[model samples]
Target: MEQSLYPVEFLHFGIHLKFELTETGIFLKICVVNFSVLGLFFHRPLALNLKAQPGENVTLSCQAPDGVDIEWSRTDLEELQYVFLYRDGHIDSDYQHQSFKNRVELKDKEMKNGNLSVILKNVKEEDSGTYECRFKAAGEGRRKRAFIKTKPISTIQLEVADPDPGELSGCRLNLNSLTGFYFMLEADPEQTLCVD
Candidate 1:
């Protein structure tokens, strides 16, 4: 009796795959060689960069090998804002910022695809703080911080209250009332009097 068989093999970067065929069935084997170069060629997802203006819009993005879930929050706060969670190819609406209620929104709602930018309108000074973007995958996640800068309101001297005659000593002072009170200026150096 004569028997016939076929053998197959595949090789790539120290990874070897072999298949053996016999009369009854086929057997397969896969062998991986421990090599340092293989690790360098693999691609891995990294944290994304997020930033925004005090009263403007911003986005926090992340890229991962698989689907991702994002959560945004501040370091000082104990709770986290779920933001727009992208999972199962849809965004969950249960989580949203009350402060941003209707004024803010996320672009490319599919957070799993790496577009997690947030839009905010009429940003306030209190909103100028560090915001964190966290990405979750397979129960593991990473965090990145975003900074917001707000413009400070210009300070104007509203009024210079009238001081007692004893308070006016050696220096000459000018006063302006923000309430539109027109004070009379007297040149008398004897006593400081309030005139309006």
Candidate 2:
């Protein structure tokens, strides 16, 4: 197998990219990144999938250091829309979104075995959104925890929907309407019938 640079360049939002083409696949390279704005594209989280029906309990799963606190947030909502927050060994509701005030909880209060999953009780359609779980590990020999950086542990795409309501027109669209056919019924005169 051989690989060579494609001789192409891409400069978007101050970040330059060079793509390399190979016999088997294409590889992308990030040449530069802008510091003025948040580099979100370069720091995406690990994605997970979850599905649940409305009115059912949903779990946005994540796991990290056993003792570190975790925060659950939704990206589709406004910035800093903390879906659920746990810090300093307890749940913090100060900045939690109003709608999630009483509907969210930690699956394991102690985060045993590094389980940082959250439980959303009685989920609604509105709950369907992208969720991110982050954790901040404290520095060694530090007696206090600080918000230095919240590294993402996982990103979950939650889908809260009700079962499909069966199609009920009390009649079927035979779909034979487009094509007309002439047929004889009981040896009678030929008649054209198109079922719609």
TM-score of each: 0.36, 0.56
**How close to the true structure is residue 59 of candidate 2, measured as C-alpha lDDT?**
81
Show where candidate 1 strays beyond 4 Å: 1-54, 80-89, 93-95, 110-113, 138-196
> Cα miss at 162, model 1 (Å)?
31
Q: Which candidate leads in TM-score?
A: 2
Q: Which stretches in model 2 have alpha-carbon errors above 4 Å? A: 1-46, 138-148, 166-196
Candidate 2 structure quality by residue, lDDT tens digits, 19-70: 8998989888557765432222222345788877778888888866555556
lDDT of 2: 0.66
